[model samples]
Target: MDVIKGLLVLACAWGFSAHSAVNMQQEAKNISDLSQSMTGSKEALNTNVISPLSGGGSLKTFDRKEDFSFSIGTCSASEVFLKILTQPQSSGRLRLLAIEQDTSLDGNLDKFINVNMDADMVCSNGIMQCTNVDDFSTCSSFKWSAASDRTVGLTRVGMSELGGCYCISGKCGNALAWRNLKQVLTDVAGGISASLAAVNPYYTMSGVTVEGTQATVTGGNAQCATGSVTDLVSTTDPKKLASYQNDPNKMKQDSQTETASSWAYQAIQSGSLNPQESSEIRRCSEVRQPIIDSAKLSDIITLDSGTGGVGYCGADCIMLTLGTVGDNYWNSPCGEFGAAARFFIKDYKRIKSAVLEKAIFDDWIQILLNGNYIWSGPYNNWTGQAIPGQCELSTSWNINPNVSFKHLFNKNGVAEFKMRVMVADAGEGYAFARLTADLSCKDTKTDTIANSCSVYQNDPECTLLEERVDGVLTFSSGAITGLNPLPQSKTISQDSCQITIQRPWFNKNRTYRCNVKTQSDLTKAIARSEKIKTSTTAKDYQDIQFKNGGIVGDSGTLNFDNLPTVQPCVQACKVRKPVYPDVALDGVDKGVVNPTHYDVTYKECSVGVCPLSSGEELVQACQCTNDFAEATAIMQIMRNAGQDMICSTGIEKPL
Candidate 1:
């Protein structure tokens, strides 16, 4: 937008065509209007102070006697030159008076003449008058501002000129004694016109590309010969791009991703506790000693063989199902336990060849077969195939309820035998084994079994029993009834009859742990954590531009080298239709009344003087603007792609 005003004249001419008589007529009208505007120049001049006139008002003086002086008629000098270019010294009533070289002076052409003036004029609101003489009012108001070297231009130009003389019409108002301002204006204009004529096609038609288009001067006063305009384009320098190496947003994303991944990996490698384990610990803490903690027993009971048949096992092998009402018992009788199994395989041949090995037995409670303790069940081989071959092991044992279960302690808590029931040659088999227990106990405090069982223990009717497995005394059975009946029975199905054991297990280490490997939900948690840990690696998105060899600042400054070169983008211009439709010549209307096709190359530069004759200000300005735009676009893309690097501290709030 800033470069538009300077090229208006060139643009209009370049867009014209000779057959466009209507446009030419409008251009002529435009020149007429410009001339009419300048016609008031004489009336616009400031005339309160006497301007030394040479006969017909010529500024040139020929003799020393002809050197003039005047008095500012009625107004103060300050009002005449309201904008003082220098510090006020109150030197004299004369607003401006000086001596300068006079070519016509005697002896030498360098001889000088003196011009003086006094504040005796009344000049206000575009009218000037001497003390008693007639008023001098011919030109419009003269406006100026103090610029470099204390020089000023007229009207709007006066507000912006740094140091120069410019004339649009041939004259520059009245030439005062300060300098030959009028001549300077004329010479500058002449030089500009001559220079433009040689290179600016807008003033010449020698290389005209369009048949109907006509090139004209700025005021549109005259048309030039056919000619070509200069070709120029805009470009950005990459080295000037700003740096973003230390942006906080990018760093935060990177940090989050890294930390999350590490935590996820750790969670996967190690295991975590389940809520049920904590509940068991809390419940056991309140109960009395001598209690068989079923919760502790469960923790140590891991699968040794079989899937979904009898014991605890992996899902792919055997999954254990606790029995209803009593299997997941927190506290159970020390020596009484039960087991049932569900085989996963339905193959007739596989089930027939399947073998059921010893799965679970009490460590303290002993089962006697002919006075020998039985710590495990003998191998039972099946011969018939059946789906989910459910089986239960029933073992009856003698009880000494007078003894508290706390006396029966194994370091690992679990009193179970490993079971591996599988078909000999078949890879598929149901080997899962599960256990259940009736955690019922009766206090003998009121009817002490100790006093009554003492007599029976010494009798020959009750036989003491024991068993040895792997050199460990795993089971022992004893009878404590004075008569042929056991102590009053306690059933586990009645909750009110059960005792609450509240002691935590001594060995907290799990026989089998569950984690991300066992649960799909935990796997997703790990993925989310990893996302956070990897976010920061792409912190400095600006660095990506460097891969393309673009020069950007490694520091906070800018680099302009290696900037991309955008080709001159073309656009559709007004289609010049023929005045009268006719036959075609080269696929176009070429009748006498039809216009010829015109093709002229032009550039819509973003900055700088088009035709690029001089200064680099436009070039630099355009480069800076374009580079910043590109950087912004790239950053937005990153944000949209979910690579936002903005640092966050608390939970993200909803918009």
Candidate 2:
């Protein structure tokens, strides 16, 4: 959505038919409209910011072919620029300014250039480099994080090599003259691209063969003649690319990493939390832990990053891992305890700063904990020492004196809290549970709708229990008795620590219409063992991204228990019959309505062709493509069939 618009005056043309001028004009209008439509509140991202220039625009509805992209206005000044080139996805909503190269806004237009995005990281001097993890150490990752040094893979990617400059009205070309996306550097010692230059570009790529993990770029543009080839002539030195290839690998991978809280340290940094604000994070490294500790759990849980994410702490090797704590039982007697975290890794020498917006289990998680009939929520408290105000039970229920009544926490710079709870009952002495105020655990699918399933557990008599749709635990048996007898909530936290009142195993919705996740909804005065959330999907996932440390690709993994199948996504737009229908040009296309086609006024591109140009383009891009196995295999045959080519795109959002 973020992009730059420039007017082009056709001059020299190459690699394309002599129709550049007409095509160029049309492309300009298309790109401008697209970029303008996606710039602010209308952007595809969950956290859509409104730029004044965007005029509070509406969001563009994207299909599966659609991708999230916004060009940088400050390529040389901020980390946001680096994020685009290194790691291209954001699991959470973000403000572009957080990663801007220069907050000062004192640079010229040349300083603010548009970097075209594709499947790869376009390196300086025309050589291309791409990785799933964010390479925070590279200057290309961050314009001025360190002094510009070519040996560090920090220099500007060669414009000629990137290969998309406009040449004369209708022609396009690549800046670097290689067969495809990879350059044909002679001194680079026979790149994989070298042998495949003449081959169908996608056929020669290093890693596109794998499914759900790759996309490609080809050698040609809209017009068969113009594209990367014409753009490569502008480079002053041909071997600049060779020099880059010679640099030794700057860093290597490391061993395992450690994170203290339910939200690990590395995850914290990756999330890029700002500490100066009200809802800020503090340091545990600086504070001393009680030397004499009792609760100790061995490390069983592993934390790290793979595709669609960057490791925080700048070291490419390190990943956020929370060593396994407790045993399976600790996972949650009823599967209540949950956790999630975000990390922002950078190459610069600085501890990763991240905002860990953990899920607030509230009602959905409550269903699991109380499925056995225990109603509980946050206590009445507060802490005055912290910069941000914390809402906690003021009295600590007068039960467990050792557990503090309140603690400080943050949420987007606004004061927030993490609560430690206790089970208040007639029989129990004063059993207090240690709960993190950290909002890391999220795993609830719907806050409004219950997603409980049924299951049987324990060695006692066979009991028929309903697994609260979350797939966590089972509550009372239909035939009730001792462990089966009914119980009710006594009272809930009467203070600011937002708590929820729930009756254990009460399948029916809460008494009030409001909610059961927070204290405000406890007016009915009930009791239940307040259980903490265990994953990042508990609170209707409203404020959460489908992605987390557990997520792997653009298509998020499924939680059959939390999320269920839905009907195919479809919306029909009126077919626009071509203004001037074309007579039969190809046998298959003869007399076809072809109502979807648009004309070209730009001399830069080809008319009557698929929007896509190559296999790589067909695979990963947002454009309607012929990449479907049967469709693309057929297209390949058609390519061999020669001359009369025609194609159609996807019709809907698939399952």
Candidate 3:
């Protein structure tokens, strides 16, 4: 192979070897040791904590001047926020959680501060120390001193007031811990390890616009204001993920179904069908068996009337209903099977039509009784929900209309997010997650041909069960949660897209930045490559349209505040190339931009008429590329940072 290919091979090898050899537990312990000593150390300190994968994380610094302004309350276990920061990372397997803490210290420390260490992210049974030992030890004075720890809730505050102690206190600036440069270098080279994002608590951006220099955003709201974030960074290589081989659902299928079926079977042993609401209770588990084996169907007639509310009895054990249709709640019976109500609601026809069509049906209804997402779903198996008066959604949790929740993240290691926000607690906060992965799972079932998974794939009820087992099935979720998360700046980068255009007329000043946003579905993110635009205009100083209150050429470049609410033309401009009529590079602005100047380009060609049969040329076009209709006059604009607008009016001839 060539030199380039050889380099890649070597690089990949180095990454694997370094990660495989290091011990995560020891690395964390070492950092803790160093942080404990940073309190009184004389060394100048700088603690660098980063998340290489996910965004919305941060590093907080508390100088000797003050304690955190917010009073960390003391509570038991009501829903609270969580924040975790991971050290820089390597491959998927070599991941590690750096620091985990509640946004508010209101909950009792679970097992001395075990984080979301469930099957998803691995809950450490032992206490997870929160103090940044390496961070604190960087302090020259605090490094050499001894360490002291005080625990309140899940957060342990490590204070090293004396000198000499550095690496143990878990605080930065201590002389003993961060006195070496080589160590920091090693840490920087490896990358971030592990972390997570919010579990629920959809923070809504109550509909309102907050204007800014670059863009307008949803206004501040109470929902997202309470978010807080704490982060961590490490240097050692991380652990790898274990691959699954077998279907996980097989065990559940073997045990859970048997148990459930037996319980239903034993209920009939009582013999007295009238045990409780006799008819309804009997039909509850009784009518479901025939449809599973595909022998019959439900006739859904008079749907608008009431038949849609009841369940259906199909062939074999396949019992189809509104709530338990496709991958919905398990094919369970819902609603009453008594009297005229059953006659009007039983949806037998709909089931018959569905079975013939092989349609795995799902129905979701979100009504605005007032103005809210009266949260409902594709209930394929339940009744009384769509029955206007008997709808169960009305009784469910109230979805706040004044809220707008959004999850922001980049698949790559770098990410950031921001919002004009105010929580029930604070003004605004932000979180930048890095190094995120699926630690554990819930019902992550594997399937095989012997498992009739694809046949019932559309059925939500069967999804958790019918999906054959190839490995262990488990519940999983994110490891960290950022509350009131906002941001100072967002970093966007992409190598896939690259476009550049240079002006062939006159040079102009400009500015550029790459743009990225999560798709409307929020599953994947879309990015616009580096955008280069001119930021200049001939008349940066313009006046209001004679409202009997305007001046011209003396506005000192519109600042947008005094101007009408109109969209600005462009964002950036750079005058680099001199005026060009025809040269190799006279096309787009791909060349280096001039922040404080303008780049002008020009092009000239003979144009009259195309060479007809008599050698006569006819047409109003020249050799202008990029397909511009009017090359004689270009838009006029001045490139200036302080101007109200970047580009000028149309058809302004260049000097």
TM-score of each: 0.12, 0.13, 0.13
Worst 10 residues of 3 by lDDT: 282-291
**Candidates arranged by lDDT, highest first:** 1, 2, 3
Better of 2 and 3 by lDDT: 2
Off by over 4 Å in 3: 1-80, 103-450, 453-655
Backbone clashes for every candidate come to 75, 138, 202
Alpha carbon lDDT at 293, candidate 2: 13
Query: Candidate 1 lDDT (Cα, whole model)?
Result: 0.26
> What are the candidates' C-alpha RMSDs?
47.9, 36.2, 39.5
lDDT of 2 by residue, 402-513 (tens): 3222222111222112222221111111122222222122222222323221111221322333322111112223421111111221222322222333222223211111
- Deviation of model 2 at 91, angstroms: 25
**lDDT of each model, Cα atoms only?**
0.26, 0.24, 0.23
Total backbone collisions, model 2: 138
List, residue by residue over 1-655, the lDDT tens digit for candidate 1: 3224223322333454445646556666566444433332333122211242212232322222344533321111111111111111132111223222112212122422232332211111111112322222221222222232222222321111111212111121221212222222222223223223333212211221111111111211111112111111111211111111336675556556656656654664474445333211110011112323222223333433322224433322222432222122323332233332222222111111112222332122222212222222222222222213323223321222221121221233223322222221211111112232223343332321112223334544433343221111222343211111001112222222454221111111111111222323444334333333333131211111123544332211122232334435422122222233455666754444636443332222322323222221222221212346867988888776553444375554332
Model 2 alpha-carbon miss at residue 653, Å: 36
lDDT (10s digit) by residue, model 3, range 1-655: 2334433333333343333334543554456444533321222132222221112233333323332332221111123222222232221111223222232233322222322221101111112122232342322221111112211122222232211111212222232112222222122111111111111122111121212201111221222234332211111111100111134565445455555656555677655445333122111010101111111222222222211133333222222122112233322223321111111223222221112111222222322111222222223232233433332232222122221111211121211111111112111111111111111111212211232223333433321211101111111121111111011111112222222211111111111121223224411111100000121133232221233454222122312222223223211221133333343566645564643332433222212122122222333233323424344233322323324443365444333
